[model samples]
Target chain A: MEAGKRINVVTKILAANDRVADENRRRFAELGLKVVNLISSPGAGKTALLEATIGRIRKDRRVGVIVGDIATTKDAERIAKHDVPVVQITTESFGGSCHLEASTIRQALDEIPLKELDLLFVENVGNLVCPAEFDLGEQAKVSMLSVTEGEDKPLKYPLAFQVANLVILSKVDLVPHLRVDMEALRANVRQMNPKVRTLELSSQTGEGFDAWIEWLKKP
Target chain B: MHEASIAQNVIESVLRLIADGTVQGKVARVYLKVGKLTAVVPDNLQFMFGVLAEEGPLAGVKLEIEEVPIRVRCKACEEAFEMHEEIRLICPKCGSADTRFETGRELLIDAVEVD
Candidate 1:
């Protein structure tokens, strides 16, 4: 009986992206590589941290990097000086998607020497809200939160806080000057997701970076 | 705004429904279940839906968004509750900070209503 044109269907809005994320996961699994998605708001020190992280780990670990920006090879350029295989996926054609989708990563994966690296870091475009939504099939989604962004950031952008496996509070050296309440920031992050591990560091001063390097130590 | 892509996703889902041929006639509304945790703003989604869901069978389709509150549970005491504010995460009884999300952080088209 066509009494009413009623159709009941359940759909996942990210089904397409999730499918690509799954494929990327399988690809990374086959290559036996650990991929970490480095997400942050713009100017949160993602590139700087990567440059520092790669420098510290390159002696022992074969690391590769992929940089995604709305439009720029500047990050890729910065990582190249570290003598690693880095590719830049500029999303100018994709209407400047603020996040890195699995499909974007898939296209850039071909140029990366998957078999030659122990760890791969995908520095996603700097936006807390959008990048938190797209999963690039990384082993962990790590976000960098700087002190200047304020303590209420996690509460205001809870999705970024909730989804991140780990959150690194960057630019701690500026905390004294910026009046960033570290405890309040930690409380906000814990309230959003108590399970998220956090670390406070200053890349410029090289403070609290040993633990960062230690966390990435090959297991 | 990513709503442009999100609106496209809604249309794709609706198209798939029509392709399945289970429901008859035109699509009147697309019901979306947006968790409070997702960053998709309702207004943006609505505007994008209006713009992107304009071609073919999805033209002039309505989007009904149901926002779900963020729910969490204490890992230490198994306290299942929703927080009005994100700063207060302590278990009222146990006072433990060990808590995890039990819900929220979801964005899905739960069920679409067809005309």
Candidate 2:
């Protein structure tokens, strides 16, 4: 072997993941199912929001969930109470991947009744940064930030906000008690992603959830 | 962090190249291009790569990373420029909020040096 031989192999690092994601997207489209990838930091009310969403939309829309967590089937158990088919992807067994990759979701899809569900929510493992990097073939990527997390989160974690199709300011019911500035938070999110739609809602209070439900119903 | 997973992917990619005879010799270095918008921390990626490469054909391989700056095109004024100080999507020229990223989310293995 000769020294200093250079091979120009320009290739996307996540090509395999992206290819799987594209296939997932096609599969979802063919099934006429709307898939939403929910990303957030820990304790951002993703499961609670899903529980609320399922309660409201279940009457008209058949919903299924794929919950990704570092460990535990706790979230799946919670969603199962809502009587919807839910699958849990525990990353701990698979080297504790911080985020859910497309391949993981593809495997999870095998357990889901895709033909019966109108909407599928993939509750990504609660981490803002890593989840944004991996595309999961969702029609929308919704990122949640709680009021307690601080107003500067969007600026600090710009990539998560930049890629989000919708930014949900969760736990808005606690805003009055906290020192966090809602205006500043909104402005920071806007700075990172100008075109992203934002909604301030508290899953606990159900305040501002009507808009969220409406957004979910959009064609 | 996801850098570990990314490092594994990088090693796998190179190994695949070698298996297919795309990469002929033992790899000395892997050159990666990561954009500013990517979540990867270059230092972390390098560390992870070194650790994960210790057992494979990529053992003792040098990981070279080139950071790519964020560039955006203003939809309003059609001016394309690089974002320097901060990653605000607003256009610098037109001051318009309607702008699309041109080159910032890149995560690619550009080339490999073999011996």
Candidate 3:
């Protein structure tokens, strides 16, 4: 070995994770499943939205959910009440992983009936930044922002908004009470991602769920 | 926060490379190219890498990071530019809202220097 010799190894640091994510993507495709990775900050209404979404779509489409959390199985329990196949991935055992990686998703898939479901939702751990960096092999990455969290979230956390395929303004029913500007939020999201779709909905009142369901049903 | 996991991944990547004979001898430094858009804090990443690599063959490995700026191309006018201040996707040249990111999402291990 020569002194101070350098080798060019231009590759992704997360290459291993990315490879597994590609595998998960293939698996999803083989099962003809539309996979969506839902990302958001804590208390952003992901579970509530899923409960509402499953209630609406379960009548026509078979749905499954993989919920990731730092400690509790509370989210998985919530989704399981909807009578859909649900898997809880508690990251506390995995060194409290802040983000749900591809390998985790791969393992969770074994617990669910993949072929029997028309759609699968990976409710990523509630943290906008880390989850945006990890690819869970989902067809779409739907990032959520509640009106209660304020409109500047997209600007403050640009990467989450930038990577999102669809930005959902959750808890919109309480917008009138909050000082958050909905239009500014949409504009901020657009500033990060020009072509990404935006939607507003409230799981409490089911205000904009029709559009959400319609978006889900799109080919 | 997530830098610990990322640092672990970097170590794993280097170890794999060494095991496969792509990286030879004592690893001295690992060069990384992280895009600005990535939420990674370089200082935190360096610290975590040092801690994670302390007991292994990568002990005392110096992690050198090169941050790449966010760059985007306008779809309407076909002009490209780099964003220095705030990351806005709109094209600076044509002022078109239709634009796409060209760079700044990278998280690559560019190369390594060994003794």
Candidate 4:
């Protein structure tokens, strides 16, 4: 029988992923590495924000990154320019999986010297959907949304905004040229996630980068 | 895309329960109670489950998704109603946006109808 017709198939799958995720979490704790899963829509400025964050924070803390992309090692290469340890997971190798699974993340971490890093940032395959469902033993889940992506993103992709503890509104420099309604975006985000902290800044302009860096540095 | 990952999480949780002797069997059905706000799309998730469960111990298990619509209980008038559409947080009966949500933000395995 096809599993879709009569089965509680989604539940079984989530249950299974949670099992491995727990294991991944336990291992992450043992290493004392604060894992932060960065998620956003494609071109929502996740890579740019990370580049800026790493440039400033790398001096004070030991950092590493695992970049997830549908194809190409481009992101990994971009991050490597900052001189941090990085690995790229190309999902095309695995039959076009959109989100990185706990098992895949586990394998990726195995190749990294976890003991040498203070923080490990797994830049999820540029997606706002599936990435929120899986836990990679991260200390915090940060969602990056660029202003150019518009304010309606919070309502449209409520799942990511709700799960996020910190929401970084990136590409703020474009706000002058773009018609983004900042107040509406903020209000929408607050409506969905009452407690989520919001930061507005541009990675290109180095605006609000300090506050973001300081927040991440906190225990 | 994330549905596949979600499917993986469900499998792991069930196996853990089974390993601990809390549940026994070649699995039957897994029931999840997801809040309407959760990022999961049931249709996409259902599609991914079939692919993920192909060769695992849960090869033949069923995945049932029950989406709990956003229900808010107004603090002022003490009323509860379903939040069906758009991004309105105001209580329809009281017209107050000050209502507190009691549930529907959850992504949990409420029950496992196992065999």
Cα-based RMSD of the predictions, in order? Answer: 2.3, 1.8, 1.6, 4.5
Model 3 spans with C-alpha error above 4 angstroms? A1-3
Q: Local error of candidate 1 at B104, Å?
A: 2.5
The lDDT of each candidate is: 0.83, 0.91, 0.91, 0.79
The segments of candidate 1 whose C-alpha lies over 4 angstroms from its true place after superposition are: A1-3, B21-24, B75-79, B85-88
iRMS values for every prediction: 2.6, 1.2, 1.1, 6.4
The worst-scoring run of ten residues by lDDT in candidate 1 chain A lies at: A1-10
- By TM-score rank, best first, the candidates go 3, 2, 1, 4
Model 4 misplaced regions, further than 4 Å: A1-13, B7-34, B50-64, B73-81, B88-101, B105-115
The candidate that achieves the highest TM-score relative to the unseen native structure: 3
Q: How would you class the docking of model 1?
A: medium
A1-219 per-residue lDDT for model 2 (tens digits): 456888999988988889999999999999899999999999989999999889999888899999999999999999999999999999998799999999999999999888999999999999988999999899999999999999899987888999899999999999889999889889889988987999999888899989999999985
- Clashes (candidate 2): 0
True contacts kept of 4: 0.27
Tell me the DockQ of each model, to 2 decimals: 0.56, 0.76, 0.81, 0.27
How much is the lDDT of residue A30 in candidate 4? 82
Estimate the lDDT of model 1.
Answer: 0.83
Tens digit of per-residue lDDT, candidate 4, span B1-115: 5566566566777777778766665577778877776657888777777778788888877767888887777787998877667644556687765666677766776666654
lDDT of 4 by residue, A96-176 (tens): 778777778988987788999988898998888768766776778899898888788888877687778899898888888
Q: Residue A59: error of model 4 in Å?
A: 1.9
